[model samples]
Target chain A: MEVRDLNFTYPDGTLALEDVSMDVHAGEIVAIIGPNGAGKTTLLLHLNGTLRGNGVVKICGRRVEEYDVKELVKKVGLVFQDPDDQLFMPTLYDDIAFGPINLGLDEQEVRRRVEEVLSEFRLFEYRDKCPHHLSYGERKKAALAAVLAMKPEILALDEPTANLDPKSVRELITAIKKINEEGVTVIISTHNLEILPQIADRIYLMNKTVLAEGESDKILADVSLLERAGLL
Target chain B: MHQEIDKYAHNSPLCNLDPRMKVISLMTLIFSVVLLPRLELVSFALLFSIALLFVSRLPLRFALHFLKWPFMFITFFLLIMPFSIEGTPVFSVGNVIATYEGLKYGVLIALRASSAVILALIMIATTKFGTLLKALEKLKVPNALIQILMFSYRYSFTFAQEFDRMRLAARARGFNPKTSMRTLRVLGSMAGMLFVKSYERAERVFWAMRARGYDGSVRMLSELKAGRRDWAFACFIIAFAALLHLVGG
Candidate 1:
């Protein structure tokens, strides 16, 4: 996936993204870290044609606008920060099956994928439960599972580990790693600096724009750069 | 989340029964109760509802708790009837006169209302709200209406939780509400904030749905199927309602 000179402003004239540009290779784990009010989420939304900006976003060498919204969604599954937003269906099983069913898959395939992801996230027992009943960590996992059930080539997550306990954070990192090992390119936007080196292959320190982009060690070791981005 | 009835519904002995069957059967019973011409037949309807409540295994106190509101409402109307209708005067209070006809009419209305309410309560208390919505969908209810009901049922708890949190935050700031304009203004602003927040959340939720390939219609994983026992339960309830209607007529 590639974004070139991306610029976006909200309808209220808030300059969200300015000349933002990044490239994510297939089968890579990319992390975009920034403080509050950064444009990380805006950039992720552009990847799946959910938000249109004044730049070009190409997935698999084709411009995002060229593909139908439904087709684009199948290639890039974007998970929101709030599980309540993502899991809007009545039950967890329905939420997981939502994507696959929309993709025009058969009922048997949809059921199989739903069951597979629920078991993978250890959420099989909560299949019939609603999102409000799940714990914060479980909801987060369920949200990711809902997206993964879509079988997207690129999985973009917005703030996957905000407000999580240390244990949940660790488990989420392991889950992301497992997903990455399965060859799905992962893009996460978060300020949780603790797990970057363990999970992220590359880091982009962003504040309304990309301030620094490099290997995780190089980016994490740069104290002055991290401080400049207000991430310290 | 205040889901007392929903909690009971999930754990009730009749929870596993097909919701479509329960809805049809219980609705037929309620119609019979409402259509009964004689007040004497109401006793049978009340007894039938009580039997259903027993079979459901819901706590007696919990089932009766739902009757409190209907009782209060009926009592308010019943209070005016004794003085309004002109007939054989049973008692007199200055210009106000109580009549035996008005008293009997009030009793009949109260019995009919309470019996119907209990039967409706039994129906809802034995089926999960989501399952009930699906039953309604299968029963030829409009899709848009069913969707509205589904969202309202799901998010009412969320909004309640949000309201409680906002109230707690106000209390933490040493805010005390009383019958004053200032209190009203504070509450008004809180409600406005909640509306705005809900709107923003709705927009975000729509985008999330769009990201997951949600077009317009909603699809679910579970399908309801009525078994032999469900048919038996429905047949028995319908037969009992018909019997009551005929015997009363």
Candidate 2:
């Protein structure tokens, strides 16, 4: 995944992101870290073409704008920060199967994929429950499973551990590692700095733009850089 | 309110039955009750609906609670019918009169309404809301209308939570709604805020859907199929309703 000179301004004249760019290679886990309102999510949105910005974002050598939105979604799964927003389907199973069905997959294939992802997330028990019925941590897992069911080449998650407990956070980190092991590129935007060292190979510190990008340890150890980025 | 209904739906005996079959059974019961010439058949239809509710394992108290809202409207119809329908006068009071035919017509109307409500309760009590939406899709409902219904059902719970939070915030500030201009103004502003928030949420939800590869069509992962028991149950209901039609006529 490649983003170059990305710039975005809301219709109300607020510059959300400016000249932000980053590169995520295959099988890599990249974390975008910064304080709130620092364009982390804005940058993630551009990864899957959910928002069109004045920049170049290419996936597998093709521009995101050139690919059909539906096709782009299959290649790059984008999971929102709020599970309520992401899990809009009436039931967990439907939300998980939504992407595969939209891709015109057959019934058996969609069912298989939905079941596989649900079990992988340890959410198979809540497969028939509504999003509102599940606890916050389960809902988050279900949301992630909904995207993972699409089997995207690149997974983009926004704040995957926002409301999770410590145990849930640990479980999610392990799940992410397992997913990355399966050769799918993972890009997450989050404010949880402590867990970054364990999951992210490379980190991009952004405050309205890409302020710094380097290996996780190199960036995590830069106290002055983090302080300047408002993360400290 | 929705969560309460969903609780019963999940545990309903007919939860595993095809939603299409359940809907069709309901419509048949309703139409048969309406078309039955004799009030006896209407009563039979009501009894049949109640029986099905029992078979579905919905508690009797729950069924009565679900029917309460419609029962109130039916009660109004019953009260006004005695004054409207022209017939032989049975009793007279100051500027008020009751007639025999009017009383009979009122009872008939009450029975029909009751049967319809009972069947509706039974259907809703048995089928999951999500499954019903899928069944509506199969029944040829317009996709846009179906989507509107789906989204409203999905997000109304969230909006309720938002409203509850706002209410608590108002209360926390020592604001109590009463018959006063200040309270009215505050409530109006609350409504406006909720509308703006809901509108923004709709936009975010659309983006979420787009991110999930939704391209105008709401497809289902599981297809509905009528098995032997589903078919048998549907046929039995239809045949019984038809039998009542012929016998009652």
- fnat, candidate 1? 0.71
Listed in order, each prediction's TM-score against the native is: 0.91, 0.89
**In candidate 1, how many Å is residue A116 off?**
0.9
The DockQ values of the predictions, listed in order, are: 0.67, 0.66
* Candidate 2 chain B: 10-residue stretch with minimal lDDT: B1-10
Off by over 4 Å in 1: B80-106, B178-180
iRMS of each prediction: 1.2, 1.0
Cα distance off (Å), candidate 2, residue B92: 7.3
At residue B126, candidate 1 shows an lDDT of 80
Best by TM-score: 1
Reference-based lDDT, residue A214, model 2: 96
> lDDT per residue, candidate 2, A41-151, as tens digits?
888888888789998999988999899887898899888888888888788888888888988888899999998998888888888888888988898888888888889
| Runs of candidate 2 exceeding 4 Å displacement | B1-3, B10-13, B36-40, B82-106, B172-181, B223-228
